[model samples]
Target: MASPVSQKLEEKLVCSICLELFRVPVTLPCGHNFCKHCISDHWHKQEQAPAGAEKGYTCPECRRAFERYPELEKNVTLCSVVELARDGEARVSGTERCEVAHGELCPQHGRLLELYCEDERQCICCVCSIRQCQRHRRVLFEEERSKKQALLKESLEKAQEESERIKQAMQELEERTRNIKDSSEGLRSVILSKFTLLRKALEDCQWRTVARMEQEQAAALGHVGENWSLLKDRLDILGQHRERAQRLLACPDHRAFLQEFRLLPSPESPEALLPVEFDVASVVEPIAEILTNVSRLLLEDLPGSVAPKAPEPVGQDHRNLTFNPETANKYLELSKGNRKATHSPGTVCGRQEQGPRFEPWQVLCTQGFGHGHHYWEVKVSSHSVILGVTYHSLPRERQQGHKFNIGLDGGSWGLQVREDCYLAWHRGQAEKIQEPLYKNLGVSLDYGKGLLSFYGLGERTRFIHSFHSVFTEPLYPVFWLCEGRAVMLCQRD
Candidate 1:
């Protein structure tokens, strides 16, 4: 190994910006030395930075300011010393790098890795950059690090959100399981009481019918059990990812962080939550065929899950929605019946601000839903429209860096209809859903069940997506219209 004194001299010859040994060393007015090209490139980037002042030729190391760009003088003495240090160290330890070889050194080149190779997905040294990866995509290690750091944060956020969704689903599944068991037992009691008044022959039929009902209960419970296991597995995966991401985010060493990030596996895409409904009516209807007409009468009065249920009428809960004019932005125009909203920048809806009007190009519905099944339909002229439900607590003021603030927080959820896909936005995270554009869209809300679904209206209502969450307060339907986009609330008698 080379002596520690030579290693210290080599470290002194390193440029702070490039973190590499000086190439063509130059001295600045601030008494700091750096590579000639490195100092020039730094000043060039400073000039191109936005909102720069008249003069900003500041030294990166000492932070000393200069009125004008200073002339770089080649430090011939320091350059000669750096060369002697390298040659002396080479002779002291033949073909062995002293200090740089200890950590993050190129095994083949024996140089400190300063650049990141995009094509190879690894950090590379100076020699590797020109020799093997000259034509490959190369960037500064810090540049690649910042970009990956952003992605790491985004992935962590998604894991937290998915974990919450799975927990809620598990709770709902347990509650539904309990209700099925109670309803099935109540029906058994009714059948047993009816058989006691009949002869011994009827008692035999009662035993068989009760056995069939028990079998139906077991089958329904088994289906729910399978769904519960699926959600459990997904929750475990998200939890592990969240823990690892947190640790990586806290890592102080950029090299170690980047290395671990490359090896981290991506979370799997979430699966759709299957609809949990058991057809109790079909199982009970067969008993009518085995017994007298009285058996059919006993089945009619069965309650809840024990009885046959008619198909829920989607139209019965249809809501007539209208835009709240006071909450509309200046660029949005409301129709005479307040059923249509059109966005046109040239034509102002109202110049003066009225009430807590939306600063973003958005509007809120006049009605809010609290506790029941509700369905509504709307026709959009084109894409670039956002329709969703939000709480009244949503800020009515302007939002920064965003055209609309519908799904930027926890109080709101939105489905942005893009030209090629749909983006489900909640809590500032967007989950993209790819689907063909549909003009007529339907929104269904089951408040008691904590389900909100969106559908595309065509030959039949096509199920697009759904969000399950326990909503605390009443939700109002909100909308945003881009320039030249129009949304009309479809009228249904």
Candidate 2:
């Protein structure tokens, strides 16, 4: 182990910037030594001062000023001394060393800094405190160390809590991703099953059509065979008559020929044959009808049959909705997916002025419901926001502080959330509520019953407020946001 003298020397060689033995120490024009990076950062902060103020550089330790920042040069002597001190103290006894080596001895009185001056928040030696810290509150070195150690322990506990919270969030995210994959696979199976049913229906129709065609073919061939039999019998009788006449003519007697002709029975003339017609078009008419029916059933009936229905619970009327860009304020930016809305920093006018847009820092959803119960949620990112439902005619043009804006007129109703409290607004009326609306809000609108409700959906579902109104026009999901704030429509299955 090194002696106390060697430890004192090592303390003097440390740099104040990093609070350690100096490496490549540099000196300022103010005659103060520091690590090069520390001094550079100090000057950089000075340069960032407000415009039109005095442009001057100040020493980090002494607060001495310079008209212009000087080019820093390496303190060759201090650098060499710090290196030697580090090498010489390689065999130091313990790691419990003083934070500020300069504190080891007072600059003015050359004594140990065994006391802390609470008023100045600095360490001072007994002799120096008597001279400079005469009126300051003071504590012994051990007392101050104990107080700091308790505070450090508390900080460590808080850090551990924060770390555990992060781990829980990560696990939740992984579980949610797995759920999405499972849902997609399930949907795929349903779609394939529906198509398979459709294919089976078509195949059944095909077999029936083929059977009907075969039956018609057999009947047509049977009719042709019957006509052939009748014609063949008539031809055979005529052939026998011709053979009898030839035999009488070969007898060489007119009397014999006349007797044979007279004796032969008279041949009857065959009736004219009727044309057999194949009605191919009539035969395949059923096949054409089968094709049309299959197409109609698949396109019209299958979707409604396989589609999932929404639950009718208070907070379960989940709908996939998007914000309408045409209805957004010029200062508000809607994301490409239309799921999120935030304030834009630009003042340029680009969007067309049309549709049922909210001119007073608000925007409406793309779809509206006129009947049945609908539910949706929004993830809020700001305290100064209003979420609610409104009619499509809720004034697109800006008016002079018109009470007709969202939550302020008969056409709209809203829940306004602030950092500390919440308020329900309708037709220029406001009601104060004690509950805190969280980051994620669930909105359920029962249009038929005129019941509109809001729920805070973080950790647990907490009902905030509800509104009842007479039936009128369709109601749309609307939001009002302050500048530099954002809110997103939550997507759910």
Candidate 3:
């Protein structure tokens, strides 16, 4: 059923060396057709022959001898004929030429898509390319497929890299989360232990105070009983004298009355009654004093005065904190080994700016903390003082208003003790601490959890207030005082 022209085209498309339809057909100078790979293999065998025997290289179809393997050029005309023959053969055998539904074939030419519109990134039949994509870039179907594969590979590689980065980030986040949980657990244990010790001390103090009150009451009552007995004896003597006098008066015999009077030995003058002093005030005053002293020891000075037994500085070893002389205000006078800051009446002349110092009566601690928890104590003399923490970047120059003052505005957090109550201040906001007045205050900072807690030190530590946030910079303990106010940082024992 082969047409004449088709048979002739097939003859031209066949490779003589392999006697098969040409694959990558190459034409020698002698006009012989051969597959490029077949001709190269034929010549490779010739070259492998003995040196002198290699001279008989020739075209396989014509047996035309050549000096060497002839250079070959791909036969462009034969290449086109091969494609046409292939399509015709497929049609004669009734093969499905179009992969998609025949309905989607080019309406005018009835051909399957064999080209791609590069500008549109779409596939099209040859007729559609000429009609619609004439001015656009075009490529054969196989060529476009090759390009697409390369692009897909590049995209896939980028995705893999991004996925790996995301995985690494996730792992880092999980590790940080675990660290936080572990740190919190350890902190919780320490906090509980310290609180337990405080509770135990308070209980012991309560028992001692109660026992003392009971003992005082017992002694006072015994002394009152002795006084009562003495008064009773005096009353009895008076009663006996009254009876004798009445009997004598009523007696008919005057001689008996006179005789009794003389024998009576002059009724002993009644001893003067002395007052028994068992007032509630005397009992209560001493008990109150004892309680106050115990509470003050436990709350205010317990953590410092007890040395190694005192609660360890949270999350760190004990450290002695003192005012940084370089950062002290001109009106502040440091004494007691530089641990105390007394608000002097006048500023010293020629106060050079050393780093950063407070302008309106403030000073910073010697050490600055960037991480972990820290705790320190300050002993204040009166309510006209402020104790707090601030970042190193906090403004050191005095401002016009109280906006930059510690416990009054941003960049610092403070506890201001007033005659009436305690105020915790941050960013211009104030929260009153309802706890009782305290002279010694303890400030604790947990940088990890962004917590700053204040406690009134007494027989037991009383929570005053806390500020919570994610601190973005290093924090240093800061203090504010007016004239006549004095504050001391308790030395670590």
Using all chains and alpha carbons, the TM-scores for the candidates as numbered come to: 0.37, 0.36, 0.41
Error of 1 at 397 (Å): 2.3
Candidate 3: count of backbone clashes, pairs at least 3 residues apart or interchain: 9
Best of the two (2, 3) by lDDT: 2
The local lDDT score (0 to 100) that residue 17 gets in candidate 2 is: 65
Candidate 3 Cα misplacement greater than 4 A, ranges = 1-110, 141-147, 266-493
TM-score winner: 3
| Local distance difference test values of all predictions, in order | 0.80, 0.74, 0.73
Worst 10-residue lDDT window for candidate 3 reads 91-100
Cα TM-score of candidate 1: 0.37
Worst 10 residues of 2 by lDDT: 305-314
Local accuracy of candidate 1 as per-residue lDDT tens digits, 1-493: 8779878888999999888778668999889999887899999988887874555889998899898889987676776576555662243244334432455566776655667899999988666777899999988767899999999999999999999999999999999888888888888888787666565657766787678768877777787887788899999999999999999999999999999999899999877765666655465456533442343334433353233222233568999999999899888999998899999889886646667989889999999999988889889999999999998888988678888898898678899999999998877879788888899998888777556778888776566666655565799999999999999988788
lDDT of 2 at 44: 88
Q: Return the candidate ranking by lDDT, descending.
A: 1, 2, 3
Measured with C-alpha atoms, the lDDT of residue 166 in candidate 3 is 99
User: Which one wins by TM-score: 1 or 2?
Assistant: 1
- RMSDs, each prediction? 43.8, 32.3, 21.3
Clash counts per candidate, in order, are 0, 1, 9
Query: After superposition, which runs of candidate 1 have C-alpha atoms over 4 Å from their true positions?
Result: 1-314
How well is each residue in 266-287 modelled by candidate 2, as lDDT tens digits? 7898866646666664765545
